[model samples]
Target: MTIHTGHPFADPDPDPARRLRGRVVGAVTLWTAGDRADRTGLTVTSLMVALGPEPRVLALLDPDSDLLAGVRETGRAVVQVLTWGDRQLAEAFAGTAPAPGGPFRQAEFVATSYGPRLATTTTYADVSLVGEREVGWSVEVEATLDAIIVGDDADRPLLHRRGRFHTI
Candidate 1:
């Protein structure tokens, strides 16, 4: 059927899967280390693009969460793009992967062009806080671009789809 411009809801959706096939949102792995450095950091799926390229990224954090408090105090955070190999790190932050108390030996971290880079090896952009906005139940933070740490030789990106990490 031909779709008319003036008519509402006239266009037929052809191959809806195409729209969602590769659609990926920011699953910025938040690394929060402070007083309880050993038990810090968390994986949050509430990240979003704030539009434009003014070095601005908006991350939504629960105002009542400990991670949120750390971000507020430090005014900084490292945003790492996840890779398939980094699933353990992501899960640990998500509170599903267990940490064996003391020192937390599951993952190792190294320094890079960005801040402290995680050894699970994901591309990342270290950002510094620029500003914040509070809307009801969430705290949105705007951060400035600091540095970038490229991952290993692999190119596949870890994707968050339907509450789990898939590949794209």
Candidate 2:
């Protein structure tokens, strides 16, 4: 038997791996794909940077999500870093909450070759799908960064850990 240490993201049972990941904080974002009548997106925390001269991007998307379907069909997407004020919008895309005028209404977006990106995003990347594979419960995607847009509020980022939102 092991002694229990009560930490916010700690596991009560044997699955320490998942609980530990819950403690590894991540920036939150809305990952969008397609355009106009075909647009789809989701709140994402599983995005990561692939280091090199030109940094590539990787993300694990739900295999069944509309955003994944759109990305798989169109081979394009937008990764827009969210701000602290975007909790509601994130939740809406996460399907845990509702948005009054749907998720897109919460923020303004502009079209790009990869999809619609948040107009106010301090950092956004337009990506073209380079590769994809089935990984557990997700569709793991590798994408080439086609373009990047940076805005004014670069320091403020929306983050997630312990199953809740935070700011930095």
Candidate 3:
């Protein structure tokens, strides 16, 4: 039987799984939606692209984040892969850095039927929300591919591991 170890909140290592998960490397991305009037977006490293019976984009998104709301209201989003040069933009979207016109100011995007696609990035996808389920503090989203744009920079992608960014 597992024994209780004081209050979960009081413990320093509240979730050892988080530390372990941090060791896993993930590609950095920016998930965005809505228009400039009501635009919202966030940095993400939990995006997974699965190509099987049906192409899908699976991701973990903060329930309270503007991006989530934008997806809900607009029914679409654009997922853009990032490069090492996008580090500052990532921080701004993560809410750890300041951006003058909000996080959207960190980068430019073009309007698409699916949502706002990041203008500078060559690799990005226009997706439509297909399914979703709540997972703890975040929402697990599954989206269907509406359109995909690929460019030459697919080789260079930003990676996150052990709390910092790395690139090949």
Per-prediction TM-score to the true structure, in the order listed: 0.67, 0.86, 0.88
Each model's number of backbone clashes? 0, 0, 0
lDDT of 1 by residue, 1-168 (tens): 976667674446645553463264545464543443423466766676554666566777777766667666766666767667777777777777776752235677654332345665556777777888896578887887676666575667666764568776
For residues 1-168, write the lDDT of model 2, one tens digit per residue: 766567765445756777787899999988999888888889999889888887789988998899988988998899988888888889999999978878887778888778888877778888888898988778899998888777787566899997899886
Question: What is the RMSD, in Å, between candidate 3 and the native fold over all Cα?
Answer: 5.9
For TM-score, the strongest prediction is 3
Please list the Cα RMSD from the true structure of every candidate, rounded to 1 decimal place.
9.7, 4.5, 5.9
Query: What lDDT would each prediction earn against the true structure?
Result: 0.63, 0.86, 0.86
Model 3: pairs clashing at backbone N, Cα or C within 3 Å: none
Query: Of 1 and 3, which scores higher on lDDT?
Result: 3
CA lDDT, candidate 3, residue 28 = 95
- Poorly placed runs, candidate 2 (over 4 Å): 1-14, 152-155
